[model samples]
Target: MAKEAKKIKKVVLAYSGGLDTSVMIHWLKANYEDCEVIAVTGNVGQEAELVGLEEKALNTGASKLYIEDLQEEFVEDFIFPTLKAGAKYEKDYLLGTSFARPVIGKRLVEIALAEGADAICHGCTGKGNDQVRFELAIKAFAPNMTIIAPWRTWEIKSREDAIAYAEKYEIPLKITRETNYSKDGNLWHLSHEGLDLESPTNEPKYDQILEMGVSPENAPDVATEITLSFEKGIPVALNGEKMASVALVKALNKIGGANGIGIIDIVENRLVGMKSRGVYETPGGTILYFAHQALETLCLDKETQHYKELIGIKFAELVYNGLWFTPLRAALSAFVDETQKTVTGEVKLKLYKGNLTKVSLSSPYSLYSEEFASFDEDDVYDQKDAEGFIQLFGLPITVQALMAQKGEA
Candidate 1:
């Protein structure tokens, strides 16, 4: 059952300065008996979206706006852990928006608690995964706090309803009827959904909707090569030059974006039990994941590496389902960290026309031995030993066949 939003004196809203949120500030006041609304917008690398947000929030009716700079923490704390775990939702999505929700939700709770706010509000629609992501994180931190999800209880039904409410209230919005596509952007990636993208049969209008980079068809002919360095599984440098986490992602975004890399269109299963289509441009994150995996290849042993693949799939599901702060996720992260102790290394990659080609990879803790793997004569390993090993390995199969041959009923 949805929680009741009653007796709420003050509410803190997760404001994005987008269409829904911009209209929400005014709607909350009108519907919630004119409750005091304080808006909080986390600066998780929504570059242009941050512009004049304070003025917009204040103008619309928010008492005050808090735009917290969470880019560095978003990368170091959330992104690196997922990257190290090799978590990719459904083998494609890099969990850009998925991992970002918890960080922002945590900050929302902080601001709400500090301001003595009675309830927290959000503009997420009822059918979206973000509503689950935001509310779960909020409940984890502030279990007693009231969560006011207007979409579930309000008269507004769809994007059209939202725009009508905004128009009725004389509220300003950046999106129009023609360009009203649902978008989520942060440092790691930019995602586009809704409109023509909702139809699986229709090809994405990449030429018109792409914001982070150009389409693969229009990518530059020449390949772009870059060297990336990692320490304890976190990206620390690019092209042999050390950089801060945020700077490194930004730099790689520029390079990878130019090369038309890291764009994926997927029909993902939402936690709401619906399949939604989206196109994600994760240039920097794609490069980082590729490089990290290359380093792991040289560092991790077969057993550990293969087992970690299962862990990665689970990690992806957890993040996609918005279980970021749970104990299982933490335990998994700890195990990934242990594996990453030897994940310190450098990887050189060539990016061209949306393709990532590994040029070279090296690590100090590399387990690869050229001598044992070589076809030429080597004293390190004896080929004759394989006979006994294969015999033991095939014992179960041999016994099953012998039983059948002897007709042992």
Candidate 2:
């Protein structure tokens, strides 16, 4: 629907085979003059969503479909770095969908260039954060490439309108009117939005919507205990069995989900300056973040640990705002890597009925010296030294009190 001065010959779409992208394939071809639509799906741990995706894309009117296996890189490059940075959007969201956009957008640009496409398209809506995420990545990689966002330009106003359009074209859909919650899934987490979730007062239909795990009430009566080993802040093993990063996360997802560990319903402030409600299930990610912070207590010094917490807030903002490819993020990542150097350790945890309780933690780099911290007398730290230290620390307070007495006199 956007008016363009020149005709677009070909478009490479970041296809997810979801309702929006599925509708976009036909919409692009029908609207543009002889525009060849090429579809690119990034396999970023969407698991079962990738099943029969090629057949679906081609059937939906795409000339060719490319499914890029991006799971390993997604876990290693994107997920781990963010994990090390300790970034969490709005303090609890874990950024399940935020970081996935850049990697997908990068692939979209690559395929568009390779296929000699004039534009890159995505199914991101105007109201959501994904539109900025997708377009910003596209702009970073392919500044001049025409980006077509159908949700921003199209006549379809709501999911109901999109469904009607899809039904008219006979496009196969996996969802129905009752089950049409906007969802995004990956290795780290699954997110649900729209529909009944839009109302803040409506308690989530957890029995109906939960896919990753059971509700707290349905979790096993017994607690589940697990040991997580980390090397340089990346989780290397679960229960002492060393596993690949991808496999480790998947294993924890199963274990953590069974115990009903990680589920949060939050009304978050979107980057688009609108408030939206969402339910997130991040069982594995929750366990990892908790364990990593526990390990940093043993490894990181007081100053560095406190400062990194500040960095985490800014890091979360950058990622949430789709500024991953920018200089500030790269610089922050570098600082995070430095902080994670000695973050090698093991942590034991108990998961029970949506609660994570730390059992124990240990590290070779631990700065905790019992000799100096014990209640009894110890030679390592002199008790008399505290008298001078407190005086110097409270000098400003003493000076202010002296000035108050002088004015009274």
> Candidate 1's residue-wise lDDT over 257-310, tens digit each?
888889999999999998999999999999999999989999999999999999
lDDT by residue (tens digit), candidate 2, 26-128: 9998898778899999998888999999999999999999999888888898999999989998899899899999999998898888888888988998999
TM-score versus the correct structure, for each prediction: 0.97, 0.98
The global C-alpha lDDT for each of the candidates, from Candidate 1 onward, is: 0.93, 0.92
Q: How accurate is candidate 1 locally (lDDT)?
A: 0.93
